[model samples]
Target: MNTWRQTSPTGRALLVTVLLTGLTTFMFLPLLAVHLSSEGVPAGRVGFLVGLLAFCSQGFSLLCGLVVDRFGTRAVLASGFGLRIAGYALLGAGTASATAVAGIAAIGIGGSLLGLAVKTRLVAEDGVPARDMLALRSTFVNIGVIAGPALGALVYPLGFGWILAACILSHLLLAIRLTLRPA
Candidate 1:
């Protein structure tokens, strides 16, 4: 609390944004297989889809690092938010298997981009203490990891579409907040 108070308002806002983004991503993870299985997807294929998402995220993290260096963090972050919005929209639609796969891939890629951009912006660009900021970030990630699944389990009874809609709203709200922030 004291550390956050000592930090600039912008830093606090950025940290909150990072936390929300992390929450949105992880909230859907545990629900994915169950949701797909409910939709009649087989267990084996659901596992493959989960693995695919992990693979895409890892691959895209490497790619995003290079892209962030070239294009700048703001642009990369905006692109990530855009991809997340699109992905969540597709997921909410629940139209076809292919669409779901593409949505998952987009979410994976966007998450990677966001992870890189947020860290770079805070540590490299804003000159925050890396150790402190990282520690704070880790705390937020852990909170999200715990809270998300519980939130998913609670809301999931309503429907997976509702969960996806909540995620879309989260990303969209973050994007709007980002746009409103001063450069």
Candidate 2:
């Protein structure tokens, strides 16, 4: 059975977005320590950077919820994706520790904003029960959790830059997708 056929157009779009987000997040996160360490970052700093990124993504959801309330999902989703794109670019292009930290933080903040907006959009939809939508969302996330590491393993050898590039491009494509489809 194809989930795509079962889902409405908006659900399809949102679900794909969730899958890609999971892919992007898991791919970058698992490999980030290696990337940083290869660049000669100390192990302690690497842990701190990873922790900080986690904090921004998870810790700021309440604030992101407020922002979503003020701005609406479309704007916030686009802005969050933009931040992620820029963050990856910075993480790839710059060698300075400060630049890396900034990039990681931007990615986290973007994830925070994007995650809340998607959830908001889901709950606001009239057709699907929020519980069903969220359950499906969780399913998509689990798929990404599996796939991201596989993709990362295949590509990381080419360079961590490849993973970063994939994340940037995936987010860019998804942003364009939502803009066109307006889910």
Of the candidates shown, which would achieve the greatest TM-score relative to the real structure?
A: 2
Q: Which ten residues in a row have the lowest lDDT in candidate 2?
A: 1-10
Quote model 1's TM-score. Answer: 0.93
Tens-digit lDDT track of model 1 for 1-183? 555665566567668877887776777899898888888888887888788789888987878879999999778878888888888887777737798788888888988888888887667424457777877878888888888888889888998887898888888887777655675
Computed on alpha carbons, the lDDT of every model, listed in order, comes to 0.80, 0.86
Q: How close is candidate 2 to the true structure, as a TM-score?
A: 0.93
Deviation (Å) of 12 in candidate 1: 1.5
Steric clash pairs (candidate 2): none
Identify the candidate with maximal lDDT: 2
Runs in model 2 deviating more than 4 A are 1-6, 180-183
Q: Which stretches of candidate 1 lie over 4 Å from their true place?
A: 125-127
lDDT of 2 by residue, 95-126 (tens): 48789888988999999988888888776666
